[model samples]
Target: MVTIETPRSPRNRKSAQREKQAWLFMRASGVVLIVLIFGHLFINLFSGNGIKAIDFAFVAGKWANPLWKIWDTLMLWLALIHGTNGMRTLVNDYTQREGIRKFLNIALWTICIALIILGTLVTTTFDPCPDTSVASALPQFCK
Candidate 1:
């Protein structure tokens, strides 16, 4: 026989609504991630000159454009948050200890926020022209 635990309070209803929203978000973000991830791989690894073409200048050139910057930023933020939420769900389900589950979730969010902040800074603040020792082979923008 299967047992179903029923919610007994109004707070449970609010939690149920949030849970539904999270489920929807997971589905939507997953679909978006498929496109974003595949497009990212194809563009970075298959298009243009291919894998051998990736270098500091390649990254700098790519981030120089606001379009690619936004693409990458969206990809990073979506993937991180989606992954964090999934992990939180898992922890809530699997961990029997409330204290342990809470600690894990707190750690997950802290790491997620830190990564998002760092990634956004890197994506948006990237400068195509940076002072390098090898000025001879530098892109014209750097010269």
Candidate 2:
């Protein structure tokens, strides 16, 4: 003979709720990431001179706009977090040892946080037209 556990039993409620939230977050973030990625690609690859037009000055010009800065920042944050969360889920599922699982999760989050911080700083504080003494080194648009 076998016994069955109820779906909403007290013992399972907390984990169930957390899992539900994670599932919803994954779906929502995936959809948003698709839009952000496509928009990024369209603007960068299709709008202007295509792939050939994506040199330093092109990036500098784009970052000059606050709107583009915000857009890139959003894309960076969402992509990093979304990927980290998915990897966390995978680590939780596959790693059998508790110690290893904990260590891997910590490492994953640490890398994710570090990358996010670095990427955000670069995106927000990027300088397209640096004040350099050398004139020829600068792009034509900068001059």
Candidate 3:
């Protein structure tokens, strides 16, 4: 006979609380992501020369602004975290083997962290104007 856990039980309560928090986070992050994504699309596609204006120089010019940098960084961080969390929920639900589940979770987090670090570095340290003898190769904004 299977026994059902009581809602008031300490163990059940803790698990329930964690699940509740995760659920709330998913909803909050999803809403924020929608706003961020739409804003990004509007700026990149509708403004200036429209989609045709997007080139290496366009990206370099945008990142030159601290505001854009912050906006993009926030978007990157949120997107990665949101995706990782969703994947984690799937892994938890579908994986039956403890060893495999643990491995998959660890792998997922490790990959997410690596990508976040790489993306943050690229966004923060990006220099559109680099010292080079080939001036013609640089974006027009750099010249």
Candidate 4:
């Protein structure tokens, strides 16, 4: 016999609102992510000399500007949150144990937060000039 499991908790106004917000966020973020991803790819692989031009200096030059920094940060944040939420939904649906479901959801959000922090830090704090003992190995722009 097949059994239909119902929600553990009855839906309330606040929870319903939260669900609606999450759904809206997923849709909006997905559209933005598509544009950001495509733009990133176009710039990285189709502009100028293409993939061959994607060296340290190429990255440095892009990051040195504020616009690219914002774009990348947005992409990172949106993608991570979107993916994490999707995973959380999956865990909730599949896991029969309450403890397991909660644990997986917490782990997902923790990882998402950690990655977003690290990625933002790297993007915002990127330094084009590296002071190296051997300057020859450094990009020409570093000189």
Tell me how many clashing residue pairs each candidate has: 0, 0, 0, 0
- Using lDDT as the measure, which candidate wins? 1
User: Among all windows of ten consecutive residues in candidate 4, which has the lowest summed lDDT?
Assistant: 130-139
Give each prediction's root-mean-square deviation over alpha carbons.
Answer: 2.9, 4.4, 4.2, 2.4
**Which stretches of model 3 miss by more than 4 angstroms?**
1-12
Judged by lDDT relative to the true structure, which candidate is superior, 1 or 4? 1
Mark the regions of model 1 whose C-alpha exceeds 4 Å error after superposition.
Answer: 1-11, 136-138
C-alpha lDDT (0 to 100) for residue 135 of candidate 1: 71
For residues 23-117, could you state the per-residue lDDT of candidate 2 as single tens digits? Answer: 89889999999999999999999988899888777888888789999999999998998899899989977888989999999999999999999
How high is the CA lDDT of each candidate model? 0.89, 0.86, 0.88, 0.88
Return the lDDT, model 4, position 82. Answer: 96
lDDT of 1 by residue, 69-103 (tens): 99999999999999999999899878888899999
Q: Per-residue alpha-carbon lDDT of model 3 for 43-99, expressed as tens digits?
A: 998867798888767888898889999999999999999899899989987888989
When summed lDDT is taken over every stretch of 10 residues in candidate 1, the lowest stretch is 4-13
